[model samples]
Target chain A: MDYFLELLIGGLTRGSIYALIALGYTMVYGIIELINFAHGEIYMIGAFTALIVAGVLAMSGMSGLSVLILASVVAVIYSAAYGFTVEKVAYKPLRHASRLSPLISAIGMSIFLQNYVLVAQTSDFLPFPNLLPDLPFLANYVGFIGSTEFIIIGTTAVIMVLLTLLIKFTRMGKAMRATAQDRNMAMLVGVNVNRVISNTFIIGSALAAIGGVLIASHVGRINFYIGFLAGIKAFTAAVLGGIGSIPGAVLGALVLGCTESFATGYVSSDYEDVFAFVLLIVILIIKPSGLLGHKPTQKV
Target chain B: MSTLNYTKYMEGMKQAVVVSLWFMFLTFPIMVIRVNTIENIIEWRWMNMLYIGAGSFILSFVWRKMSGRGISARKESIGAQGGRKFYLQRLVSEKRLSLPALGIVAVIALFFPFVSSIYQTNIMTTALMYVVLGLGLNIVVGQAGLLNLGYVAFYAAGAYTYALLYHHFGVGFWLALPLGALAATVLGVLLALPVLRLQGDYLAIVTLGFGEITRLVLENWNEFSYGPSGISGIPRPGLFGMEMDMHEATVYLYFLMILLCIITIFVVNRLQDSRIGRALLALREDEIACQAMGINKTMVKLTAFALGSTWAGLVGVIFAAKTTFVNPASFTFLESAMILSIVVLGGTGSIIGIIIGALLLILLPEYLRAFGDYRMLLFGIIMVIMMIFRPQGIVTGVRKTYEFHTEEK
Candidate 1:
């Protein structure tokens, strides 16, 4: 029972991170139908931004809570700016070209951003400062969960709820939905499709930034390449939940997280990555639309 | 008129401001925050950022002016001199000079090693390997219209097959090469069987996953692959137990790759003109419509995977024989991306185009080593710029049509 709970908590923590990053991927795919491959690099940049901000704060002897809050905000802003530029330079120009052009351009952008960071920062793993406030009282109540895990899960839940509310009630959310359904019709109805797409990139990238900061802090070490595998796994999670669905991405991420955690706990951890990809292939083979994805009707 | 000119000047100023803002944001983290040392000391280079911002604003302004007038002027001239434009197009396409061009190229390639240094010869050999790989990929991506992002998996399969066979059973390079290619072929067909129903992006992701799986498995299977130390001491390919020296070996491998390149080009060109090639092209353009016409999508797609993997596998064998080492590191997603870029950058489905694309891409990075660390960065930028400016590719392929004729009634 203890092992199961341990695995469950660990899985949920990791899953929340995947869920956040996957939300960015799914939202972009929903709006523009292009896998914003550089979103992973955006997540990496967010983590680095947080590292810099936290490092600066630590030098000034600021309180941990204030540093965390300020760092997250700065990271989100920086990452969102990257998302906007990537869309305009890499994607917007090739919006009407053949399907492969945008995909290749996205890959090119991903390579460029990765190397850019590698040249700008140290390629070796840098230890991320743990800024979570240590609460002695929580130790007695929570057996398996650490304060960091609690914060990560708690923050993710709050974000998810807020996101749900935003999508459910906001005018921007309705416009996003309309644009996603049909770009031409949405434009004809006076929806600013371009603005919606840009907003989607910003929101999605900001969410990815949160995921980046959380995961980097949780892992306590980060390198230039951390986002590559994380991005792939999160993309798998998004697809597993059904590519365009928001809640589905979170659900898929949780399931994937649990699978990875339990598999590492029970099986040889060497093959941990193998399991996620095999699961993807199996899921794709059996149900191509994913668990929650609706079947796309062909116009023929 | 004076007021209109002022308005134009204001618009240009607005454009420059936007471009400058974009450049600053893009270059800020990379330029300003130079995290140089292990202690994580923040090294700021504000001057570099300023230069980049200023340079981009100037370039953007110039680009705007040139495109504003140059494009329309060229279009009008081309419209006026239609016959001259057609003649120029034919010359540019190499229709008139193709035979002579082929002869010249063949002569240059054959004598290239003797004229160049041994180091250059080796680089040329590596470039030729990519030519074969590029040509193979061109068939699947350019002709069949299938997006495969995991081609390196098959390349690894071929190399490992040769390595394992030689390590365990003491097989010769000559015998193992074909067997290794066969192994890759089987892997490709087996992979295609389950995922043949998928189209476009999904297929790409699955293929990418499979490629990663191959690498991961190779990395983890310690007893078989030595787990990352890699298998070494694989014998070089030679004739009748004659172990040639390094120079001789270079020439031999060069010729072998050239032969392979020629065979690939010939086979691909012939296939493109064949019925099956037509079927593959149809599948690429519209799978449903082709299926309606009784063309078997499954069969065509399988053939594409089989033939494309065969070329990759053959090159893999050559790679192992040349390096005398086989490791999971050699086959990465980057290798797959580079090959795909060759096909995309070259006119997709253009035979001669793939060769030129492979050479430029492979050799440019080699020469750009003088540019130091910015080689790959520049390569990535070039890819994006190329896609934006010419998404069809640098060398567009010729579209061949088969006309149906009815006998006189």
Candidate 2:
């Protein structure tokens, strides 16, 4: 029972991080219908930015809470800037090209950003400073959940609620939904489709940055290549939950996280990654439209 | 008119400055700062910012001009005039020019081993292997429009088949070659079956997952795959039961690659005009339309995967023979990316383009050791730029056209 609770909490923390990253993918796919392969790189860049900022602030003897807040804020801003720039430089130019073109370009951009960071920074994993402080009230749950895990889950829930509100109520969110539904119709309705797309990238990237910072601090390690696996897993979550569906992305991520946790715990950790891929393949074969995604009707 | 031109120049300069400034800001955190967390030291490279600022300033101007020209050129090409034919295409079409060119290339290839050092011969052999791999992938991605990101998995299967065959049963290269190819073909068919109904992007992800799964399994299944320590001492192909030293073997492999490359080129060239080739092209353009026109989509897709894997398998066997070893690391996602880049950069569906692309990409990096780290970075940039400005690639594939005549005319 203790082991079960431990695994469950671990899964939730992992799921929360995946959810944060998956939301970006779902939102971007919602609007453009292109899998932004470089999104993983954006999340990675976010972590690296946060690490750099926190390191600098720590060296200058700043308070832990202030450093954490400042680093996260900077990371979010930088990641958003990167997301916006990547879409402009890579996707914008090939907006009308065949579907494969933008995808290939995205893969290229992903590779470029990975190597760019590798060239710019050390490839070796850097130790991420512990920024989350333990709350006095959470002492009883120490065996099952840590302070980091609690904060991650709490922050993710708060963010998700905020995101839902933004999408459900705000004018920009309405514009985003309109564009995702029918790009041409949205344009006709004067939704400023390009602006909506850019906004989607920004919001998604910002969310990913938050995930990156939280996970980096939790994991206590950061590296240039961390984003690729995280990105793939988050993408799997998005697909599993029915890509382009916000609520579905979160739900899918939790399921995937639990699945991975239990599989690794009981079966074998060697094939931990293989389970995700296998699950993805099985899901794709069984339900091509995903659990929540609608079957797209082919138009002649 | 002069005032208008001056204003335009000034506007361009202003945009360039803004673009450069944005880039400098974007790159500041990563490019300009290095933080040592353990040592608690901060190193600020302010010079990187200047370099980025200047680089983006110049690049922004070049980008604007090229995009302007690229859009107009693309429009013209899409128009009925067929636009200007690339010189490479013209060379391929005109028998007069192509014959002598082919003859010169053949003579140079035949004499290359004798004239150059064994090192050069080995590199050329590697490059030739990529040429064949590129051509094979072109069939699936270029001609069929199915993006198989896990193409390297088949390559690994082919290699592992040979290594394991020899390790267990003492099977030589001659027997293992066909057997390895068969193994890959079977795997390809198996993969193709489930993914046949998938959409394009989903297929790419599935294939990518498949590739990763294959690698992970190979890395983990210690009892089966030797657990990433890898299988070694795989023998090179022998001729008529004769024993040869390393130099002779290198020369032999080079010639063998050249022969295989020629055969691949012949098969691909023939396939392009063949009925199935036409079907693949049609499938690439529009699957629904092709199915409506009576082409069997499943069979065509399966054929593409099978044939494409056969070439990769064949090369995988050759790769094992050349290196005398097999490892999961060798068959990585990056290898698949490199092969895909060859197919895309060379001009999809263009045989000569693949050949040129393979040689340039493989050989240039070997020669330009100074830019070793930048190779992948450049490849990524090239892919993005090509998709944006010249998605048709360096050498565009010309479609087969027929002229119709009437009695009245």
lDDT tens digits, residue span B9-36, model 2:
8998999999999999999999999998
TM-score to true structure, per model? 0.95, 0.97
The CAPRI quality class of candidate 1 comes to medium
Can you write out model 2's per-residue Cα lDDT over A131-162, one digit (the tens) per residue? 88877678865656778899999999999999
Which tens-of-lDDT digit does each residue in B1-409 have in candidate 1?
9999999999998999889878887677656865432474667789878888898889788767755654565467558854333332354466667677777988999899999988899889999999999998887888899999899999998899889999999998889889989999999999999888676667888898899999999999999888888999998888787879988898888898899888888888899989989998999988889999999888999999998899899999999988899889999888998999898887688776778889988999999999877888888888887787767776667777669999898
DockQ for all models, in order? 0.61, 0.75
Total clashing pairs in model 1: 0
Q: Model 2 in CAPRI terms: which quality?
A: medium
Question: What fraction of correct interface contacts does each candidate retain?
Answer: 0.48, 0.76
Q: Which runs of model 1 end up more than 4 angstroms from their true locations?
A: B1-6, B34-40, B62-92, B403-409
- Estimate the overall C-alpha local distance difference test score of candidate 1: 0.86
